[model samples]
Target: MKINFSSKTKILLYFSVALILGFSIINTVSFFYIKSYIDKNLSKDVEIFKRIYMYEDQSKLIPYLKIVDSNQNINQNDIVGKVDGKYIVVDKGKVYTELIHFIISISLWEIFILFIILIIANHLVQITIDKEKELKGILEVFILALTHKIKNFLGIQRVNIEILKINFNEKALMRLEKAYMLMEKDFEILIQALKSLREFRDKREEIDLKTVLEEIIKELESIYPEKSIFIKLSSFKVKADRTDVKNIFFVILENAFKYSEKRIFITDSMEKNIYTIKVLNDISFQEKGSGVGLEIAKFLANKYNWEIFNQSSDDEYIVYIKIPKK
Candidate 1:
């Protein structure tokens, strides 16, 4: 049978196993040490008692006195003592019991200390694992975002290069210049994204959705001049981080143009306290993508309590982003 254990459970299991093994080892070592201690002391006590019985008065050590001659048979409970070439039996149960109790007490205290150390070690390990996981997630997201942005900029540069190859005129030169400027803009956006990621809970301000959409549309037109685009947006306002909002729009629109046919449509409306924007494009249903852009967009939307929905048919793909007017 397979037992599934979560991270916390696994850590606890490791600690428990270590504790049990440690306790067993300590107990075994303590038992041997205690046995040796008892044997050594008992021998010393027997020798001392033997000397006392031989040379001193009989009444002096009555409590420890247990004398038996060579002819007298010793029972199971009797400890043998030799004095002056003769044998005597003595009872050592009281002293043995006292030593056993002391050793057990010391062992329990040591185990308690070991238990505390294990608990602290487990806690530290858990914290380290959590931080590592968080760092890994951040790195993955950063790499995906960076790669997507670079690919988009490169596509524009490739197009300009193609134009230059066909005709080396003012218009081609201007297109090249535009590509370079877009590259610079892409770099700036990346820097701003990194800064925003560091301070993800930045203060929100009233954002003009209409203005943001117009700017994105213009940018897309410059990159894909051959593609037909339509936009119909009414005035809408939302409280959000400006960079986050811009990045969301950019990623969605860029994806739409990249994956769609020659046409794309965008529309927006505001009703009551909610504003919704929808983007629709034509694409083959079988086409698949890494979907990093949409993932990032949805992440940002969820972070700001906005709602995002996606729908796709055999020939049409649509996304709706709904934000609360604040």
Candidate 2:
């Protein structure tokens, strides 16, 4: 038979068992100590009873000084007499031991406290498990989408490149070359996205920030030879994975050109322990249908614990990335 239980019920069952076991052990130890204390007091009471019954050297019953163990509930008349010129009174231990009363009285309160602690521990464990499951699902979906796109783009690029290699005529060859070039550009973008995912797999190191920016700009300029981007260098360092650094710039550069109809200005600065890279273009934000470039850039920046800012004034749109100085 398949056994099934709701999540709440399962948590309660486990918590109750743990709470019971812990409280049971504590009560057992407390009971043992209380029992030992009571036994010690009872032995002392026997000696006190002997002294009360003795009647000088004659050792005969005086009737007035009758010995009575404190454990026995004597009449008021029996306890109204003195023993050997001293008034007799019962010791407090004979009526009830403090340790025994304390153990029994606090058992309920201790059990209540234990129940509260167990409930909190169980809930915390459940919350952590749920959040971990959610993050895993998101990462799995991202990896699947990236893999599918990369495979399809590479297949097309491979076919075109092979065709271009076979052609000898200049006219046909030139057209094939252009087609292969465009396919290759798209493939590079896909590859950059893949590298961004790779950083999530425990691969991060100090990368040369300036060198990565230079390479991305070179690749972007290859597509539009007439288009130009000015670079401003800053003496700063970043502790980020090489793949991640390259992808960050690649996404931003792609976004700048896609939205702007003119030249893009790229500048870098280091102030107050922050390494900021700004991509400025003469364009304002507009409603575009399903674009992932800016979204991915922001995602990568936030994932690396870097700050991203986007602002527009007049006709200039600025994208700023602030990485912590390493």
Candidate 3:
């Protein structure tokens, strides 16, 4: 069997174990030390009582002694005598023994309560750290995605400009305009993505899955017209932030286009409030590209409680996304 614990749980477990061990050690040492101290005092008192009984002071000791049942058996360390029609008994260490037990019980209770409070404090601290880490990761991914998108647009603009310089035709001008439009659209998407990242709560609304997939496909077709693409999608509704859904689709589709051999296939279906999208493409295993986009996609999927699965063969790659409907 395997057991997994979160950071908070693990920390609490470790601290609790240490605390219990520490308290146990302290209690054990204190108990023995107290017992030894009481025993020493008890022996001395017994000696003093014996001297008084043997010599000059049974009457003086009567006031300090306690009356016990005559039938009670006295230990060798206890002192007993008859004084004014009552049997007086002086215990060697019974009082101190009870005091020790009472102190230990109270100490154990205090330690148990303190352990609970410390565990709660540790859990709260762990929660704060996790939230900060999540925010930092999202910010880092946003910056990297923005940089990658800008660089790609710049490269496209540079190519179109070079073509214009060489040919200076209406065709070149049209291509430049198209490139500018794409850059503008990408800039808008980037803004939306950043906004989505900043939101701390889900802003879910009904979204048409078919429309989102079509938009992604159209965008990719514009960028790589030569790449053959096929889509088999059913009309379905999902509840999620529009920008988040669009970004997830865009990231995966963009990667598919970037690495696919010559064709991309997309299929989707909806059943029992769950929508599954599968993307399959032919690509060699040796041609694996940088996985930054997929990483970002996976992160976003986790945030939205969606599932993503990837499988690759010698010459084919496939990705599946399972998202719940609102």
CA-lDDT, candidates in order: 0.76, 0.65, 0.76
Evaluate model 2: give its lDDT: 0.65
How many clashing pairs per prediction, in order? 0, 0, 0
Q: Model 3 residue 264 lDDT?
A: 95
TM-scores, one per candidate:
0.50, 0.54, 0.55
Clashing pairs in 1: none
Q: If ranked by TM-score, best first, what sequence of candidates would result?
A: 3, 2, 1
What value does the lDDT take at residue 255 in candidate 1?
74
Tell me the tens digit of each residue's lDDT in model 3 across 1-326.
99999777777777778777877787778778877886676556555655565545454663344555667765534555554454556654555657667676869796888778786879787877778888898889878876876776677678778988897878667766766766676577678877766777678898898899899899878876878998999888777888788878887897787678798999987789888999999883434655767877887888778998899887888999998876
Per-residue lDDT tens digits for candidate 1, residues 1-326, read 99998887788778877877877787788788887887777677776786677555653564554666767667746745666656666556665676678767877887788778778887888887866675466567768877976786677678778877887667767766765765675566667777876774566898888999899889878877777898888887778889988978887887787678788999987788788899999884434557877877786677688988889998888999988876
Tell me, what's the RMSD of every candidate? Answer: 8.5, 8.7, 9.2
Runs of candidate 1 with Cα error greater than 4 angstroms are: 54-65, 68-73, 83-87, 90-92, 166-326
Model 2, runs deviating above 4 Å: 1-24, 29-204, 223-226, 257-262, 271-273, 282-289, 312-316, 324-326
Give stretches of model 3 more than 4 Å off. 1-107, 205-208, 215-229, 235-239, 254-264, 269-275, 281-291, 309-318, 323-326
